[model samples]
Target: MAVTQQEIENRLWDAADELRVAMPEAQYSSVIFPLMFWKYLSDTWEHNHQTFLKENEALGLSAEEAHEVEYSTYQTFKIPFIHPGTVAERRASWSSILATVTQPGLGQRVRASLQAIETANPDKFSRLFGSMAWASEEVLSGEVLAAVMQAMDRTPKMHEGNMSHDVLGGAYEYLLKRFSDGSGTRAGQFFTPREVVELLVEILEPKSFESVYDPTCGSGGMLIASASLLKAHGGRGYTLKLYGQEAVPDTAGVARMNLFMHNLTQFKVEVGDTLKDPRFTKSDGSVKQFDVILANPPYSLKWKPWSNDPRALGGIAPQSSADWAFVQHMIASMDPKKGRAGVVLPHGVLFRGQEASIRRRVVNDDLLEAVISLPPNLFYNTSIPTVILVFRAPGTKVPDRQDGVLFVDASKNFIKAKNRNIITDANVSDIVAACHLKMDAGDESADPTEANSLSSRFVPTTEIAANEYDLNIGRYIKQAAAEQEDLGTLIDAYNIARAERQKTEQRMNALLAAAGIEGFDE
Candidate 1:
C-alpha cells in the first residue's frame, strides 16, 4: 500500500521530536531538513538502482552492467544517485551512515557522507547541503542523531513506489510549517504563511510556460504556490519556469529542497543579496524581467543606500528602509510587454515621506494597479498591517480603466487563530474577485456594482494625486471588510481567545510543577 501524505507528515514530525533535547526548537530546521533530504536521496536512489538492475535482468546483466545503466539510462534523471559507498567503506548515502549509529565518531561519518554526496553530484547538490556544520558531535549529540535516524528509518519508505511526489512534497511543507510554528519570529525569515502565498499567486495568475520570479524568495513558498496554482487549474505546473534568490545560503538550500520535493525541476534558486548582487541578471548588468513576479520581502530592512543602480528608477530610498528599493528592483525586473507584479509590503509604503518620490513616479507612470490592505497579524514576523501592491507594465491595462487604481480594504477579513489572524479561503476568493473586476473591466463585461463593492473600489488616479498619492484604504473604501461582526464570529473569536489563555495557563502550571509548586486547576 502507498504511504498516505498525512502518515508521512506524522512520522516526520515524530522524527523531529528526537531533536527536542538536541537543540532549541528554533534551530531544528537546520538539522531536520538536511536529514530528511539525505534520507530521501538515499531511499530513492537505492530503489531506482535496484529497479534498473531488475529491468535488465532478463539478459542476466551483471552488477557492473547495472552501474553502467544508472549512468547511460538515468543520466538525465533528477536524482543523481551515484551508488553510495558500501557499509565497509563507510562513505556516502543515508543507509551507510545510519548503519554506523552504534559506532563511535558517528557524526563524522555522517558529515563525510554529506560531503561525498555533494562531491559526486556537483551540479545538483553543489551547495545544496549548505554551510551548516551541525552533523558533528560537537553540535548535535551522537545519541540524539542516532535516535533521529532510527525514528526516520521506521517511517514509510521514501521511494517513488511507496510515496508519490505529491505526498513527499506535502510532507516537506508540513515540516516547514512545524518548524515555523516552533521557531516563532525567526520563522518569518524562511517561511511565509501558505494562505498569504496563495493570495499572491492567485492575483498573479501565472500561466503555463511563463517565467515567475521571487527576488527575496524565502523557502521558495511563493514559487511553489505558483506551480501549485497551475496544477490545481488542470495545467502542467512543471512546465512553468521558476526562479528565486534567497539571502541565506541554507535557506536557499531549503528552497531548492522544496522545489525538488514538488518535482519542479525547472527552477533555479540562487543564494545572494538580491539588492547588492542579484544572481539572475543580464550580461549588461540590467535586471532580467519575468512574466510574473510576487514576493513577501524582508520588511523595512536597513541596507547601504545605492543611488546609482539602474534599477533605482525613481530615486534612492533612505537608509532607514529598503522596502521601496525592492519595489524599484521589481519595476526594473518587470517585462515591458506582459509583465505584472504583486508585492506584500507594509501599508506605510502608501504614504511614507521617504518613498513619496518613488511612489509618485510609479503611480504617475500608471504602473500601480491595485492596493489591497490585508488583515493584521497575518505574518509571524510582525503584527503591523500590510498590503499587496499590484503593478503592471505601464501600457498593459491603463487604457481600459483610464488610469485608475483599485483599493481593497480587507483589514477585517480573517479567521482568528491561536496566536494570529488567518486569511480564510473565502476571504481570499472575495479579495481576488474584487481585484480582477477592475483589471478585467475593459476586457470583460464586469458588473458595474461588482467593481464598487463596500469593501473595494476603483479609484481614479486623479483622486489619488489630489490626495497626495496616498493610497490609504480608509481614504477610499467606506467600510473595512464591509461586513458587521456577527454573533457567530464573535463567539469564534471568544473561543480562540479562551483556547490561547488555556494553553498559556497550562505552560505556566507545568513550569510551576517542575519547581515543586502548586499548579493551576483547569
Candidate 2:
C-alpha cells in the first residue's frame, strides 16, 4: 500500500497531539519540528547506507571505507555513526535514539543524542535543534516523550524513495500553519499570513538568480514564497540566493529548518537584532543591498539605536516608534540600480504625527511607489488596520509612479474566517494586477475615473504635497456619492409640512383666546 500526503499529515498531527497534554501550544513546534527533522535525516542516511553496501559489495572495500564514500554522497544533512568502546553500548543514528525512547531516562538520552548530532556536524547543525529543553523531565515527562515518539514512528518513513521533497515540504508547512493557528497572538511574531506573503512576492516578481532578503524574517515564509513563485513560473527556484536576519534565536532556527526542509540550500539566516547589529555588510561597512527586500517588522517598537548606529536617512524616528527606522534601513540596503522592497506596517505609520518628517523625506525623494491599505483584523495579534508600502530605489525604472504614488483601497476586501479575516487568492491576484497596471500606466494625470473604478488610483506628488504628504488612501480615493432624491418631490413635501404647521398654529391661537391668554395668542 502507498502512503498518501494526507495520511502523512494526519499522522504528524497525531504526534503533535501527544505534546498538547504536556506542553503549552506555543512550544509544540520547538519539540515536534526538531524530532520530525531528525527522523527525516535518519531515514535518508539509512537508505543511502543500504544502497552503498549493495553496489560496493564486489569492490573489495572495507565497511569503514564504504561508509566514508556514502557519507560524501549524502545531499542534505550528515549524521555520523557512533564508535563506542563496547559493541553492546554502541548507538549510531536516529534509530539508535528511538530505540531508547522506552528506556528509564528517555528525556536525558534523547537530549544527549540531539547534542551529539549537533556536535558531530558543527558547521551545518550547530545549535540547529534550538533550546527546546526536551531532556528536562520537568519540561516533558518520560511517558509523554515515549508516546510521542511512538506516534511519529507509525507514520511512513521520510526516506529518499518513500517520500518526495514536495510532499515532505508541504507536510512541514501544514504543521507550521497548525502551530501558528494554535499559538494565538504569538503567531504574529514569527508567522506572516501565507496569502499576504504571496501577494508581496507576486508584486516584487523576483527573477532567476536574483537576491531576495528580509531584515526581520519570521520563520522565513517570505523567502520561501519568493522561491516558490519562481518555481511556479517554470524557473529554477533553487538558484536564487536567499538571505535573512532574525532577532530571536528560536525563530531563526525555525527559519533555517524551513529553508532546509523546502530543499533550499542557497540561503543564509543570521541571528541578531538587524537594526542594532546588522550581520550583512559590505567591505566599506555599509549595508549590503539586495535585489528584492520584503519584511513585516514588529509595529511601533521602541528601540534605543538612535544613540549608537542610527539609520538617519530621512530623520530619526522617535524612540517611541521604530517603523520609519526600519524603512530607512531597508532603503539604504537596496541595490542602487535594481533594488525594490515591499513592507507591511501599521496604517498609522502613513499619517502619524511623529513620523510626518520621515514620510515627507521619503516621498520627496520619489522612492515611495505605492501605499496599499489592507483589511483590518487580518492578523492574529491585533485588529488594527495595516498597509503595504512598495518602494523602488531612486534610480530604478518606475515610470508611471516616478512623480506620484499609487493608493489602493483594499480595506473592504477580505473573507471572514471565524474570528479573523483573510485575503483570499482572488483578492491577492486582483491586488497584484492593479499594482502592475498602475506601474505600466505611468501617467500621473491618468483619468481618475477609470483608475478609481478598480479601487485604486494614482495621486501626483504635487497633490500629496498639498495634503502635507498624507498617504492615507481615503484622503485620495473618493467614495461614490449617495443616490439623490427628486427635486420636485422634495419641494412638494416641504410645502405640505409648512401648510400643516400653519393650520395647527391657528387652532392653538383660537384655544389661547378662549382661555383669555392674550400674550400667548400674540
Candidate 3:
C-alpha cells in the first residue's frame, strides 16, 4: 500500500491544524514541525538500525560493525541513540536533553552530522534541523505537545530511498498553505503562493546538474520547487546544488527540516541577512555564482544607511526598499558563464525612477531578460500587480538574447480562486514558453489571439535604450491587437450603460416628483 501525495498532504495538514488549536499559526510551526521531524528521524533511526544490524550479521560482522552504517547512512542530523549525557536517557528530562543537544559545545556534534548530510544529499541536506526551541518548558508541559508528538508518530515513515521525502514534503507544503490561509498578510512574508511558485519554476525550467539558489528561501518552497522541477524533467542523477540565505533562524531551521524530510541534504541554506551579511561568500570573501537564480524576495523592504555597498552590484536598492539590493545580489551570484535568473518584483520596480541608477545599470548592461506582468491578487499580502524579470549574462545559453529583453503582458492570465488569483498550468506554460523564446523580439508568435498561446516578442536594446531602459511589460507587449477588439463589445457596453443610466434617471425623477421636489439634469 503506497501513500498517495494527496493523502500525505492532507494528513500532515490535519496534524498541523490540530496543533494550531493550541497556539498561533506562526508559533506552532516551530513547535509542531520540529516535533514531527523528530518523530520522523526517530522512526527512520530505528528502522535503519534494525536493517543495518541484520545486513552486517549476515555478513558475519559484529554488532559494532554496523554502528558506522547505522549512524552515517541517512542525510539527517544523527541524534545519538544513547544520550551522550544523563539528560538524553530520561524522557522526563526531555527539556534538559534538548538543552544539552542544542548547547554550543554539543551542537558541534550535530553540525558535524549536518555537514556530512550536506555533502551526501546536495539536493536535500543543506538546512538547519534540531535547532528550534522545542526543549523549552512551555512546549514540554502542554497537552498540545503530546498531541503533536502523537500525530508525528502516526506520520508515515520516509527515508532517502523510501517515500518519506515526497510524503513529508507534501505535508510540509500543506502546512505552509494552511498557515498562509490562516495568518493572512503576516504569513505572506515567507510564502510565495504555490501556483506562482509553479509558474516561476515552469518558466525557469531548472535543469539537472545546475545549481539553483534563493537568497530569501523562507520555508524552502522555492528551493523545493526547483528540485521538483528537475526531478520531473528527469530523475535526479544530475547534481543539483541549492544555496539559500535567510535572515530568520527559525525559518532557516524550518527550511533545513524541510530539506531533510525531502532527502535533500546537499544544499547549503545559511541564516543571515542576505543584504547586510551574505553567508554565501566564497573562500576569497566574494559572492559565489550559480547557474540559475530564482527568488521571490521581500518586495520593497527598506534598509537604513542608504550608503552604497560595493556588494550592491545592480546599484543601491533604496533604503526604503531592499528590492534593488536583492536584485543586485542575485545578479552578483549569477555566473556570467551560464547564469540566468527570474525574480518576482512589484510593478513599481519596473518603472520607478526613485532608484534610477539601479534600473539604468541593469537595463544598460543588457542583463534584463524579460518582464512578465502578473494579475493582481496573486499574492496573499498585497493586491498590487506584480511582474517577473528574467535575466541572462551576455553570450550565455542564448547569445542572441543578450542584446534584447522579452516583455510578456500576462496581467490578464490567471484563474480566480475564492479570494486570490492563481496562475494555473496554462498560465505557467504561457509564461515559460514566452521566456524560452528569449531571442524573439515581442513577436514570438504569429497570432497573439490564440488561447493557450504564448505571445512574446523581444525588445531591441536600441528601443530599451530609447525608453531609458524601462523594463515595463506594457511598454512592449501589444495587449490588444487589431482583431482582439470588436464593434460588438463596444456597442454592447454602450447600450448596457445607456440603458442603466436611463433607468436610474427615470427612477430619480419619480422619487423627486413624489417628494414634491423637481430635479433637472443639465
Candidate 4:
C-alpha cells in the first residue's frame, strides 16, 4: 500500500525520539540523519538487486555474473548483490546487520556494515556518513540503536519503487526542519529559514543548466531551493548544476545526503573553509565562477583575513567581521558575463564603517542592484535585522536602472510567531514584486526615483554618492513617522544602546591597560 509523506516524516521523527534519553535533542540530527541515509542506501540497493535477479532468471547466469551485470547496468554505488563467495566475511547488507541486532556487540557490526559500504563506494560515499565514532557500545547502547532502527523500519519501504523521490525528499526536509527547530540557535549554522531561501532564489531567478553555488552552504538548502524553483516553473531542474562548500564535515555530509535524497546526481559539495580553502577552482589556480551565487554566511564571524587573496575586491575586511569578506568572495565568484548573486546578511553590511569602502567600490562599479531589508527576529541565531543584497555582474545590469539601486523596506511585512517571525506568502509576493518592478516608468520626463512607490525607492547613484555611498534602506526608503515609546521599542533601543556601551567600555579598558593604568577599569 502507498503511504503519505507525512506518515514517513512522523516515523522518522519517532525514530529520532527513541534517542532522547541517550543524548540531548540538539545532537539528534547527527545520529538520526546518518542512520536514515544508511537505511535508504541499503533499501534502495536491495530493492533493485531483487528485480535484477528476477529479470535475469532465464539467462542461467551465475550469482557472480548477475551481480556484475546488475551493478554495471543498474546501480550508481556498490552494495553487495547477495550473501556472497569471496566477500562473505564482510556482510554489509542492511538485513545482514539488522538480523544480528539482538546479538552481542551489535554496534561494532553496524559500524562494520557502514564502513564496508562506504569503502565500496569511495567516490560517492567517502566520509558521507559524517563522524560515526559515536556509533559504538560505549557512546550508544545496542538496545537504543536497535530501537531507532526498528522505529525507522516501521516506515514504508524507502526504495525508489515504493517511495517517490518527492516523498522521500520531502520527508528528509521535514526532518531537517524539525531538527532545526529542536536544536535552537545552533541550527542557524546548518539551516536557513525556507521563506528567506525562497525570496533569495526568486530574486536570483536561476535558469535551467545554470551553475548555482553556495560557499557556506548549510545542509545545501539554498542550492536545493534553486533547483526546486526551476522545477516549479516547468523547467528541467536536474539540468541545473549544484555546488556548495561547508566548513563542517557533518554539515557537508548532511548537504550531500540532501542532494541525493532530492535525486540530484550532477552536483559537488566539498568540505572546507570556503574563505581560506575553496575546493572548486580552475586549472589556472583561480576560484571557479558560477552563473548564480547564494549565501547566508555566519554573522559577524571573526576570522584571519588574508590581504593577498585576490577576492579581497575592496581592500581587506577587518578581522572583527567577515560580512564583507563573504560578499567579496561571492562577487569574485560571479560569472562576469551573466552572473547574479543574492546574500542574506545583517544590515551592518549596508552601513558599517568597516565595510564602507567595499560598499563604495561595489556601488561605483554598479555591481549592487538592490537591497531588501527583512524583519528582525526572523533567523534562529541573532535577532538583529537582516537584508538581502542583490548584485549583478557588470554589463548585466538593467539598462535603464543601471545608474541606481533599488532599496526595499520590508521590515514590517512579517507575521509574528511564538518563537520567531515569519514571512508569509503574501509578504513574499509583495517583496518579490517590489524587487522585480519596472525600473523605467515608461515616461522619459518622469524621474524613475520619483514614482512614490510604497516602502521602496529607486535611488540614483549620484544621490547615493552624495550620502557617502550609504546604502542603508532607511536612507532612501524612509519609514512613516510613528511613536517610538512603546515597551517593545524601548527594549530594543536599550539593547542597542547597552551593546554599544559595552563595546566602548571594553575599548576604553584596553587602552588603559596598554597605558599601564589598571585601576581605570574599576
Candidate 5:
C-alpha cells in the first residue's frame, strides 16, 4: 500500500545505478537523473489523465477524444491516456515505441505537456519535465536502464501521493548526494553537504510565510531543506515563499523541476549569474530583500571585474576572492524590517588585512551575528577550513542575543568519509543548540572552564577585534589540547659550545700549518 522511505530510497538508488553500465558514474548521472525525473512525470500524468476521463465520461465522447480535451484542459502532456500495453492491441514494437518517444516533434509535445502542468500549479508543475533526448546512447539499452525503470515503477504509490513531498523529496536529495559522492570534485557545482545545510537552516529558523532566497540555489536543496525544517517545526500554517537563481541552464531547469516535484508552484526560481546578471527583479533595478537567506557560493570564484554596479553587492568584490560580493548581494536581499542571513565562506574573509576597509565596515556596522568554523574536508572539493557567517540587520530583537557575535569552533567535530569529513545529526543539533544559548561568561576565552555572571559574563567582541578582524574560527574558539614545553634542555646551546671549541682548535692548527706547511701540521 505505502512504500517506506527506506524502500523508495533503495529503489531510486538501484535505478540510478542503471547508468553505470554504459558511462562513467559522473557522466551517467546527468543522463540517469533526467530520465528518472521523466518517468516520475510520466507516471503522474497517467494518474491525472485517468481522473480527467472520469470527469468527461458523461459527455459521451470516446476515450481518445475525451482524453484530448482533458489533456488540453489540464495542460498535461498527451501520452496515450492508457498505458501502452493497455491502450494498444499489443505493445507496439519496442523500437517503434522508442522512435515515437524520441521523435523531434515529441520534444514539443513534452514541453507543452509540462507547460500545461505548470499552469495548474505554476510553482510546482511548471518545469518538471525537462527536454529529453531519449535516442542518446546513454539511455538506449542495457540491464541498467531496464532495472532502473523497473525499480522506479516499484516505488510505493504512497511515496507519490500524500507523503510524496517528504518521501520523494528526500529520495531525490539522496540521489543528489550519491551523484556528488560519485562525481568527487565536480560535485561541488550543485550539492552542499546535508550537515552544513542543517546547521545554517537551524540557525536561521525561517518561519512560515517568510520568503527564503538562495542566489546560487543549486538544485534548490538549501531551499527544500529549509522548507523541510519549517514543516518539522509545525510551520504548515505558514507558507515558504521561495526564490532562487542559478547560472547554468540545465541546473536551473533541474532546480525548477525539484521544486515542482515537491508540489511548490508559486515560488520563483530563475536563471542567471546572481553577481553579474541578476534575474530577481525590483521595479527600479534596486536591491530586493528577503526575510531569510542561505547560500554556499563557489569558493573563490571570480566574476567579470568591469561591471562594478553597487547593486552587484557593493561592486567589485576582491579580485582574489568573491566572498564579500556574495555577502553584499545577500545583504541587499535581506528584508529591511527583519532580514537575517547566513553564508558559508572561506576563513580568509574574517581577517585578511587586504580588505581592511570592508572588514571594518561589516563589523563596525554591527550586522554580523555569528561565525562558525567548520572542520577541514567538510567540502567535497577543497580541504580548506570553512566558516558560516550569520548576519542580521540592526535593531532586531533575538532571544538571549541582542548584539555582538557568536564564534563556534566546530572544526573538530566530524566523521571522516573516504574523501572528506561529514557532520552527523548529533553534531548538527548540538551546534544549533549552542548557537541559541546566551554567550557563556568567558565564552570568548581559550579555557572552557571559565565562568561568568549575568551582567558581567559573555563572549567578548574584543578578541575578534584583536585578531586583525580575521573571522577564522580557530582564532576565537579553542579546542582542548595541553601544550607542554621541555623542562630543561640546553641541546642547542651546548652544541654551539662544542662547535666553537672545535673551531678554536682548528684555527690553532691552521697557524702552525701556515708557518711550517705539511711538517708543522704533522
Candidate 6:
C-alpha cells in the first residue's frame, strides 16, 4: 500500500511516544531524527539495489558489481557496510539494527552503526547524529531502547515508491514542529514559527537560481521556506543555492538534516558564530553576499566580534545589544546590485538609544526600506513584540516609495493560537500587498491614509531624519480610535459612576447632620 503523509506522521509520533519514558522531549530528536534518517537511507539503498540488479543483469553484470554501480549511481546518500562479504558481516543497516533489538547492548550497536555511517560520509554526516548520551544503558535502559526501536520498525516503510520527497519532507517538518512545541524556549534556538517565515519569504520574493542565505538559520526553516516559495511560484527550488551559518553545532546539524530531508542538495550549513567568524567568504576572503537574505537572529545578542574584525560600514554596534551589529553584517553581506534582506528583530532596535548612531547611518545610506511591526507573543522564547526590517542594497533601484521608509502597523494582525499568536494567510497577504503598493507608489507626500486600508504609511526620509531616524512603526501609523458603537457603553459607565457619587454625597451629608456639623452640610 502507498504511504500517506498522515500515516508517516502517525508512525513518527508513535515512535516519539516510545521515547517519552526514556528521555526529555528536547533530547528525543537526537535519537529519533538520526534513526529515522538512517532508515530512510537504508530503505532507499535497498530499493536502488533491486532496480539496478534487474536492469544491469541483461548487460552481463554480476549482482555484486550491479549493487556497487547502483550504489554509486542512484543513492542520494551512501550507507556503508561490509561489501563483497557474507550477509551476516554486512549487518550495519537500519534493518539489521531493528532485527537485533532483542540482543544485549542494543544502544552500543546503534551508536556504532551511526559512527560507521558518519565515518563513511564525513563531509555530509560527520557528527550529524549529535551527542546521544541517552543511547547508553546508564542513561536509557536496554528495555526502553528496545521498545523504541520496535516502535520505529513498525512505522510504514519509507522509500521512493511509497513516499515522495515532498511527503517525507513534510513529515520531517511536522516532527520538527512537535519537537519544538514540546521543548519550549530551547526549541526557539532552532525553529522559527512557520507563519513568520512564510511572511518574510513572500515579501522578499526569492527568484529561481538566486542564492539565499540566513546567518542564524535555526533548523534551516527560513532557507527551506525560500525553496518552498520558489517551488510554489512554478520554479525549480533545487536549483537555488542555499547557504546558512548557525552558532550552535547541534542546531547546525539539524539544519543540514532539514535540507537533506527536503531533498535539497545544493546547500551549505556551516557551524560558527556569524558575527565572530563568518563561514561564507569569497576568493578574496571578503564576505560573500547573497541575492536574498532572511534571518530571525537571536534578539539583542551581546557580542564583541567587532573589536577583533570590524565591518566596513555602519559603526560598531554596542556590546550591550548586537542588534545593529547583525544588521551591519547583513547589509555588508548583501549583493551590491540586487541584494535584499528581511530581518526579524526586537522592537528596541527600532527606537533604542544605544543603537541611534548605527540606525542613523543605515537610514542615511538608504538601505532600510520598510519596518513592519509584528504581533507580540508570536515567538516561543519571548513575549516581546518584534518587527521585520526590510533592506535593499545601497545601489539598488528603489521603485515608487523611494523617498522614505514604509511603516506597517501589523501588530494587531494575528490569530490567537492556544499559546502563541499566529499570522494567518490573510494577514500575510494583506501585509505583502500593502508593502508592494506603497513601494510602487514611492510618494511620501501622498496622504498616508490613502496608502492602504491597513494602518500602513510612507514616512519621508526628511521626517525620519527629524525624528532622529527612529523606525518605530507606531511613531508614524496612528492607532485607530474607539468605534462609535462603543460610545454607548462608555456613556452608561459614566452615568453609573455619577449616580454612585451622588448617593455617597447624600450619605456624607446625613453623617454631618448627625454629628451636628450644620456648616458642612449642603
lDDT of all the models against the reference? 0.81, 0.81, 0.68, 0.83, 0.66, 0.80
Residue 274 lDDT, candidate 2, scale 0-100: 89
C-alpha lDDT (0 to 100) for residue 363 of candidate 1: 84
State the lDDT of candidate 1 residue by residue for 1-522, as single tens digits: 878888888888888899888788878888788888888888888787777767776887677876677778854333432334653574367786788799887777777777777777777877887775888788988899999989988878887788899999999999888877777877667888999999999988999999999999988999999999999988878899999999999899899988988888999999989999889898888889999999999988999989589888678988989999999889888899999999999977876666778878888888998888888898877888799999998798646555878887777678889878998888788888877664432222223364333266777778888877766666665564234333234545787899999899988998989998883575
What TM-score does candidate 1 get on C-alpha atoms?
A: 0.87
TM-score of 5: 0.76
- Most accurate candidate by TM-score: 4
Candidate 6 ranges beyond 4 A from true positions: 57-64, 82-88, 308-312, 439-453, 480-522
What value of lDDT does candidate 4 attain over all alpha carbons? Answer: 0.83
Q: How would you encode candidate 2's per-residue C-alpha lDDT over 1-522 as one tens digit per residue?
A: 656889999999999999988988878888888888888877887887788778777898777877577777743456654545655354546688778777687777677667777888777778777886766899899999988988999889887589788888888888888887878777567888899899999998999999999999978999999999899989889989999999988788888888888889899899998888889998988889999999999999999846645457767888888898999999988898999999999976887666778889888898998898788888777788799999999957467677788887676668889868999888888788778774433232223353323367787888889978767666676541112233224545887899999999999998988998877743
Off by over 4 Å in 4: 81-90, 440-454, 480-522
Per-residue lDDT over 53-96 for candidate 6, one digit per residue giving the tens place of the 0 to 100 score: 67776888777876567767866556776333755455468887
Quality of model 5 by C-alpha lDDT: 0.66
How well does candidate 2 match the true structure in TM-score terms? 0.87
lDDT of 4 by residue, 1-522 (tens): 787998999999999999997988778888888888888998888888788878888999888887789988877788643334655354577677777779788787777777777788888888888878668888889999999888988888888889899999899889888877777876666889899999999889899999999999989999988999899989889999999999999889999999999999888999999989989999987899999999999999999998699899878899999999999999999999999999999876776667778888898898999888788899876788899999999879988668788877777788888778999877788888888777652111112353322376688888899988777665564351231223233445787899999999999999989999898845
How many residue pairs clash (N, CA or C atoms closer than 3 angstroms) in each of the candidate models, in the order given? 0, 1, 20, 0, 14, 2
Worst 10 residues of 1 by lDDT: 439-448
Evaluate model 6: give its lDDT: 0.80
Q: Is candidate 5 or candidate 6 better by TM-score?
A: 6
In candidate 3, stretches whose alpha carbon ends up further than 4 angstroms from where it belongs are: 56-69, 72-77, 81-131, 138-140, 159-164, 235-238, 305-308, 397-400, 438-455, 480-522
Among these predicted structures, which one has the highest lDDT? Answer: 4
Candidate 1: the clashing residue pairs are none
* Residue-level lDDT tens digits of model 3 in 1-522: 676777766666666766666666766676667656655665565566667766666676556655555656631344433333664342211222233442333333323433343444455434445353554444443355445544554556654435656666777777777777777776777889988887877777777778889999988888888888778877582367888888887788788777766767668888888878888778998888888888998888878633756666556666688787788888888887878888998877876666667877777788887777788898888888888888776556366576777777676678788878888877777677766653555454434476634456787778877877556655565552332443234545887899999999899888888998875653
Candidate 1 runs further than 4 Å off: 58-64, 74-88, 438-454, 480-522
